[model samples]
Target: MGLDPQSRVLIVDDFELMRTMLKRALGAFGFTNFTEAADSNVADQLMVEATVTRRPFSLVFLDWNLPGSTGYDLLCKWRGNPRLAELAIIMVTSESDREKVQAALKAGANDYICKPISIDKLKEKLEAVGLGKVRSA
Candidate 1:
């Protein structure tokens, strides 16, 4: 989608390589701003800190199976927190079970993208969230 190049974004995944890949995928969509977290604990800390500082993330790409808490747990936590309730979250997972998809959507994920993500799929999810499509990529 047409993400603001300066839009503050967060990538939360235990695997550094996955995080890097996601970042690169987003880069193609012209997203430059990003913060990476290895697990939910770190993501929580960053969220709290950012909120306190009045610079909350504009978007978050969360991995399903994190080291401490699953992405679903983090999604629930953020959805319940008034301060972070409006943050856009997209669950990125390798699993594509229907129940899991429903659970994520019901739990307040802005969107969900399967792993080995392609630019087209990411664009589609972003569009589903009303972010629209990327201009060049």
Candidate 2:
């Protein structure tokens, strides 16, 4: 099934521009709801809030480098947490290193995207993760 247009997605990045970019990219794919975090701290708080509100985020586009903990660190924590274990997390980073990719996968990232990301590539990753292909309007 295609990703729901109302799916609550979270964008976690230290850079405001990157968050904006990802949000815009997702918007093109029919996503309409979003939450953004500038660091791991904010991400954690937001996740908790979402859980309490019973509107948990369905997807997360996470940056590898952040002010506090790294995306890998957050992924590992989430994977270990019962409430967040099922969250679909995509590591969005500039790192193209094979080892880093492997580490993120091991840490439990649902997917990974390199920096300077293209809409097509992002769509492909989403589809690969069963978010469904973006249908052209």
When summed lDDT is taken over every stretch of 10 residues in candidate 2, the lowest stretch is 128-137
How does residue 106 of candidate 1 score in lDDT?
98
Q: What is the alpha-carbon lDDT for the whole of candidate 2?
A: 0.86
Question: lDDT (CA) for every model shown?
Answer: 0.87, 0.86
List model 2 lDDT by residue over 19-130, tens digit each: 8888888888888899999999999999889999999888899899999888889888888989876688899899799999999998889889999978888888888767
List where candidate 2 sits over 4 angstroms from the true fold. none
Model 2 TM-score is 0.94
Give each model a TM-score: 0.93, 0.94
Q: List the residue pairs that clash in candidate 2.
A: none
Clashes by residue pair, model 1: none
